[model samples]
Target chain A: MTHGTTSPHPAEPAPAPRRGRPRDAARDRALLDATLAVLAENGYGGLTTAAVAARAGVSTATLYRRWSSKEELVIAAAALHGESSYEQPGTGTLEGDLRVVLREKAAAMTGEPGRLIRALIGEAAHNTALAEALVTAFLQPLYDRVAEVVRRAVERGEIPPLDGVELLGEVVVGPVMTHFLLTPRLPEDVDQATARETADRLLPFALRAVGGTP
Target chain B: MTHGTTSPHPAEPAPAPRRGRPRDAARDRALLDATLAVLAENGYGGLTTAAVAARAGVSTATLYRRWSSKEELVIAAAALHGESSYEQPGTGTLEGDLRVVLREKAAAMTGEPGRLIRALIGEAAHNTALAEALVTAFLQPLYDRVAEVVRRAVERGEIPPLDGVELLGEVVVGPVMTHFLLTPRLPEDVDQATARETADRLLPFALRAVGGTP
Candidate 1:
């Protein structure tokens, strides 16, 4: 697969489609949905192009025409899932926006989506393709959203225009990632309440890290 | 496997040996060593009791006598590996000590031990034993060491007496972890110099998080 930001897969075309038959949005949606379903049940290792095709009621040729490999398919599916789950809550203040976003992020981690994510994390160690796909499809978009939040915060003078402010997403959510993903004995439910509380506690440190008045 | 801290296996008795032949420390050492070797080569799923026994030149019964399951044995081996790798540095200041510890921790993550850790993190999602063991054996001991450093810093007035100082380890290392474990595009070698630089950048934030003067 060609490296960098552009994904060669038909599902996520590198550029605008030329001609040929215009891409079927409905069929593409079905295939992506089927891919996630297979991943949720069978995990990254168990995911197969043939199975995804069968689940989508499409031929192997159709699946292959969109994605060259299972890795590309899984990545596209994960990206689609992330896009659907992610909501840009323009809550005015930086803290308010982050609180909503972080809560949603934490909830996703504890819910069904989290299972697929964990399975992917495990499989990524062995499959570089999957690892790259995870970062490109899942993490990049989330990072962009976080950067947008910080940008607004900077404009409002809540956060100082520090050099590391651009990378504040990692700093802000590092503790959450450590808690939800790395920590074994997670608290009950790991619901929106828990996420909100965690975000409240850690936000000051993140603010301070970016030279903001916490 | 019996629940809780106590091991039910004959080779891993809760108390001192009663009237049976004295347990061979050398043999136990060899078994643990063999277990890690197998893990480093075969990963968590591929590791087997038979393979470990064969590598250690011990009988399958002998291996099973100490640890009833593959999860238990891998946890013990990983615990042993973590213990050996973790070095406590009382370098006068909290920053100095953390710099050393975090640097070492980062280097380890980019090395052989990291592979096993990644594999376990993946497997632990589904396996409670592995998750519990990861927290108990690997994370707990390291957390203790980190807490000690913060305690000394607080006593010295470098950091204010804070309620959450006990969790400074998580905060100090959270960003490093987010960069190393979560990010796919790792820098070259993930060298000690880079680790130290990252620790330098994040330590002030950790200090500030605990109400310290950075």
Candidate 2:
């Protein structure tokens, strides 16, 4: 819920008396959507608060009231985008849960969401704030979900207790990340068949890596 | 090696007659090094041919004589940087060889090379040409090396034949790449001890994934 480290404009007037919570929510969503659109079109370097505000059909002052900086706006947009794309799998078995998770993740890594993420990652390389925000907003939640799956399996005696459970996140999703990011094809060209096959193929390795039977 | 798709400036003069082969080699190295430096300092968007030329103390025409565009210059520089950093492992055992390779790659992912790569990946998200060049220059060679190691292991009866061997690259090195890139740490601040520890922890999973005993 924290917008970012920087504070919004203190002098900006409060919302109009007629402006309700639902309208405010709608405005926030519109701004975040505009942010993603801008990121997808221009990448991180080209992103600016002015451009986002203009795209959202809002004044710069309004945008500043919501986000103190472009980086914070990006972080917020990415978080909202990721939540919509990611599904928490509750499938009975570990393998089934992983398959659902991986497939969903691969699907997310294509099209506009993928492009926005790449732009963010590119910025995250040198921008500590963005990097940390990415880890916090995206990676940590994904890791926690994976850890929960592992925890369930351990309780069911499906596998031995893992010593370094944190590493499981990388072991499980790293290949998919590599395939999506390193492959030369445009994200839109990443067909579902390829993602499904990749998920099936790597499932064994993932299971083995986590001390589960394939 | 092919520089890139775009040919050098058609009207540009050839190298001076006094320029010996060694000096030409030295000049190429300097230009590539400067490209890396510029990329490290200013990500992909900020990198310019004039900046690289000025950094290398060469005319823009001289740089153009070698690389036709900023993208091509980046590709050439990245190819050279990857070549010098990558070492083919010849350790007798597969585990030992993988450990060596993983450790070396993790080491390379720290510092200037890492920053430059992050910039390139950022650019690659939107630029098809850069993406293909990255795969050819970096990922392909690494995959080939990993395949060779697997081939050796198969020949020695260390493991059964691996189908879709291409995926091995992602399987073995993907975790390390994820750890380095997504960990939110400044590349320079990535200590050797941490790299070594990550290699050690992921080694068993790598072995298991590759169908070898840990």
Candidate 3:
């Protein structure tokens, strides 16, 4: 069926009234929520558009109209989920800014975002398309935000203009990522307290690695 | 059909003549190799003991005699593959020792071990057993080795006795792991030159994080 049914104005509609803008936005949210649920349950290998559609209480046709494939759907959902996870913090010092960033990351790691991160890492090894999408949609933005934080630090004279400042993202988050994602601990075992502790412990090293006095 | 066929002393008048010790060792090696091959091709989710047995040119029954389950088989195979990947280096200085370790790790990341590592990580997100196996069989030993390197450095008064020296393993390897595994680069693109470059770039940071003078 056409998308004209949810038009805002039927009688005085101007070419189908933007074709269900509001309703489609709500449906897209539902579909993305369903996608995450299915991904958490079934993982990237097992996730199917049909399963996501069914979970969302929509027909596969409706789901396909928005996202052409499961990869597209997952990428969209992950991007949405991770969009607010990293914020460019201006805490006036490199250490202060990174502490805020790491705390937020630690908090995020104790929840669904953490689980999704693990699953994405697991699948990205084999799936090049998903890997590229994850980099473009999630990691690139995170790196850019971190670069912004470093740039602010440099401007403040908190740290000198380093040679390899771009490597700061990996240096800052790598240990924390290894702790939560690569460690043997199960997701349930990774609570907020331990996550925060790990973040606190690694922050000094991160600062040192970033060429700051910790 | 019995393991008695390959007995070294068929007529030794002992019960089953130790059950084909030499031949069984060889067979076990073949089975483990086959398990890694299947794991690389099918991943942890798609691996089957039947497929491993077929690849090894042995019966499933024969495979089961050594490892009872696919998890056991995979763990054994992974342990064997990763066993030689780490060694305790006594390069006198922490930097020299860590340099060797990181270079070896970078080299290992470009080959089959790297691929298997990525696959295991992907499956380990959802599979607690595999995750535990990886930690106990792979990560713990690697950590122990790094700890040894740090301990030697401490003994030589290279760095003061750090409180959280155990975290050195994660610190030393985290950025490298993030660069190779978590980034968008495909496995084929992670060649020795780039891997070495990443390891070299992160080396000074690692030393600094470990409280050593870079």
lDDT of model 2 at position A177: 85
Per-model C-alpha RMSD: 5.1, 5.9, 6.4
Q: Could you tell me which residue pairs clash in candidate 3?
A: A122-B122
Candidate 1 CAPRI classification by DockQ: acceptable
Off by over 4 Å in 2: A1-22, B1-22
Give the DockQ (2 decimals) of all models.
0.45, 0.56, 0.56
Error of 1 at A49 (Å): 1.2
| Residues A1-214, model 2: lDDT tens digits | 3332332222343344233343555677789899888877877878898999899899988888877888878998987776664557888888998887787778777765676777677678778888898998788878888889888989988888877787888988898888887778876776777777787787887877787776
User: For candidate 3, lDDT tens digit of each residue in A9-125?
Assistant: 323423433554546666777898999988878778789999999999999998988888777789888767776775678778888888888877776666668878778877787
Of the true interface contacts, the fraction found in model 2 is: 0.63
Per-residue lDDT of model 3, residues B25-112, tens digit only = 6677788889988877777878899999999999999998777888778988877776667567877889998888888777666666
Error of 3 at A91 (Å): 0.8
- The model with the greater TM-score, 1 or 2, is 2
Alpha-carbon runs more than 4 Å astray in model 1: A1-23, A84-92, A151-156, A159-167, A185-189, B1-23, B85-89, B151-156, B161-167, B185-189
The fnat scores of all predictions, in order, read 0.37, 0.63, 0.59
Error of 1 at A190 (Å): 3.1
The lDDT of model 2 is 0.78
Q: Which stretches of candidate 3 lie above 4 Å from their native place?
A: A1-20, B1-20
| lDDT tens digits, residue span A1-214, model 1 | 2222333354563355442444555567789899988887787768788999999999999888877888888877766655554566698987777777667666666655666676677677666777788887776667777788888888988766555544466666676677677766433346667666675666655555555555
